[model samples]
Target: MTNEQLQIRVEQISHDFFKKPFIHKAYFNNRLRTTGGRYVLKTHNIEFNPKHYEMYGLDELDGIIKHELCHYHLHIGGRGYKHADADFKNLLRTVGGSRYCRSVKPEPVRTPARYMMLCQNCGMKYMRKRRMDTSKYVCGRCKGPLKLYKMEEANGTQG
Candidate 1:
């Protein structure tokens, strides 16, 4: 939804749940990466991760809005508003807001091994992402001399 729609929704939820009006702005923040929403302590504004609504739908967005509203209302009322605060926890639980947001992105992919170390004596191989000095290291299994080879070279591929 658009920022204007989000602002209206946040305001409505605030009034419905907290019996308090959210005077500050509430908007979607695309740059928010790890959080569903955040309440700005200084500005009393709430920023939501648009990905939450796009990925999980309105139910999740409502939960996030309620969660942020808990902080907003408590802070505005001069009460404890942090996650660890009892007031915040009670308000959040009362509103049935989500304790935590679900992950919206996948785990990062690991880069392929770029180098390989082979033991001359035991034929054991170890993969590494960086080149190691062969002369300084020995095989763990047989204490044999180790040789480092580029993965592309070992695979017979030209880089």
Candidate 2:
């Protein structure tokens, strides 16, 4: 949904559930990788991850909105808005908000070899996580001087 829709929804939810008006902005933030939603303390704005809605659907988005609203309302009223606080806990339970921010499946991690060393005489290549001292460590195959080069991808792209 658009930022305009998000603002309307947040305002409506605040009024309907919290019995208070939400004056600040609410928008979808695609850059939010982990959390389903976030309540900004400085801006008093609520940012929802649009991917969360696409993945989990409307029900989950509603719960996330409720959760962020708990923080928004409490913080505005000078109440303890932290997750550990009793006020926050009570409000969350009352509004049926999610206890924790929902997390998304993370992208697969890749550990590529950062450094590569080549033997001058034998042309034997070596991969390493860290830069090596080529002068001290000669090629085992040909006992030749090694030339170091950086590798961007572990798939064997030359640097």
Candidate 3:
């Protein structure tokens, strides 16, 4: 749906469920890859991942919206709005919001490593399962200093 449509939906849901008005913007954010939705503390705006709605449909989207709305309303009402807080949990449960913003299934892990750290002086490369500390270690070849030259996580795998 369009951003305007989403705004309307969020406002409608807020009034219907929480008996509060959602006075901020609500829209799809393509850059939101992992999170289903997020409520910005600064702007009180809500951003939803369009991919979530495309993949999981309306029910899942609604749950995500409700989850964000819980944060929005609680924060505005001057209550404990963090996920770990009792007030947040209670309101979320009452409204049937998702406990966590659902994560999209990440891309597959490659065989050996998802990132590669390279030496600046010797051009020696080290493939790593996780992010390597460049400051701590040096290259095996020539004992040269290392730098994070190539990050392969974005291309073929999700790290």
Candidate 4:
């Protein structure tokens, strides 16, 4: 969604759920790599990771907003606002906000070497992510000539 839409949603959620108005800005921040969202204590602005919305949709987005809102409201009230604080916990539970921001880390995939040149003599296998020139490289295990093999899919599973 656009920043305008996010701002409107944040305002609506603050009013509807928190019984307060959110006068600050709420916008998508592509630079947020790990966090689902964050509340700026200095500016009172809320930034959301666009990837979270893209992957998890509005329901997850709303939960993140709720999490950030807990921080926003508590900080504004001059009460305990840190994650470990009593006021923050109480308010979060009362509002049914997410206990933590949800951002899933991507799993790394290991691909078997597709370009292999076997020592025509020594039966050695070569694995590599990139296609290696058989004429230029040899199998380190046996210093045998390498042979290109069929490419296989790596276990690139999502987290």
Candidate 5:
């Protein structure tokens, strides 16, 4: 939908649920990648992610609007508006708003260990992603001499 539609819907939601008038503008922000909606502190504007509406439909869009409205109303009234604030949480629960604005990003992939340190006396092993000076660090288990070995993952072997 257009920015005008977004503005109208946001205003309606603000009025119906929040019992407050949102004097600021609301728009569809294409640049919003992570959040479904955001309330700008400086401009008092609410920006909605068009992708969220396209993927999740009107119910989700309404929830996003309600969530932002909570921020807008609380901030305008000089009340606690942050996620961790009691006022924000209570108002959000009263209005049945979304707990989170959007989904979280996926966790990054883990890289395999590149180097390992082994103790000469006790045969204790240590794994590391980066190369380190084995001479400087002693084995924790037996305080023995430590030797660094490169991990060979292709053949599933460790030296």
Candidate 6:
């Protein structure tokens, strides 16, 4: 939804659920990666992640709006507004807000090791995803010289 619709929705939810009028702005913040929404303490504005609405629909978006409104109302009323506070928790529960937002994306995959280093004296092995200089580095165990080898060569694979 657009910022205007979001502002209207937030204001409506605040009035309907908290019995308070939300005077500040509410908008979608595309830069938000991990949070569903945030209540700005300084500006009293609320920012939402558009991805949440796109992925989970209006029900989830309403839950997020409710969660942020809890912070907004409590902070304005000069009460504890943090998640750990009793007032915030109680308000959130009363409004049936979500405690945590669902993940939007999966964890990134790790790249395979492309290079291996062997210590001549201590027999220590090290794996790395990128090439490193062997002339300046030494083994931690024995201060031995390190020999860099391609991972395929170390694995006995000729290419």
List the global CA lDDT of all models.
0.92, 0.88, 0.86, 0.83, 0.87, 0.93
Tens-place lDDT digits, model 4, residues 1-159 = 999999999999999999999989999999999899999999999999999899989998998899899999999999999999999998888878888666567888876465534465677655566766688876677777766654543223211
Model 2 clash pairs are: none
Candidate 2 error regions (>4 Å): 106-159
lDDT of 2 at 17: 99
Candidate 3 lDDT over 109-150, as tens digits, reads 767676787778977768877877799988787888887644
Count of backbone clashes for each model?
0, 0, 0, 9, 0, 0
List the RMSD of every prediction in angstroms: 3.6, 7.1, 9.5, 7.1, 3.5, 3.1
lDDT of 4: 0.83
Return model 3's CA RMSD, one decimal: 9.5
Give per-model TM-scores.
0.81, 0.66, 0.67, 0.69, 0.70, 0.75
Clashing pairs in 6: none
* Candidate 5 clashes between residue pairs 3 or more apart in a chain or in different chains: none
Runs of candidate 4 with Cα error greater than 4 angstroms are: 111-159
Which residue pairs of candidate 1 clash?
Answer: none
Top model number, TM-score: 1
Candidate 1 stretches with Cα past 4 Å from truth are 120-125, 140-144, 149-159
Candidate number with greatest lDDT: 6
Over the stretch 39-152, how does candidate 1's per-residue lDDT look in tens digits?
A: 998898999999989999999999999999998888888999999999999999999999999999878899999999999999899899999999999999999999888997
Ranked candidates, highest TM-score first: 1, 6, 5, 4, 3, 2
lDDT of 2 by residue, 24-106 (tens): 99999989887888899999999999988888788888899999999999999999999899999999999998886556886
Report how far residue 62 has shifted in candidate 3, in Å: 0.4
Query: Could you tell me which 10 consecutive residues in candidate 1 have the lowest summed lDDT?
Result: 150-159
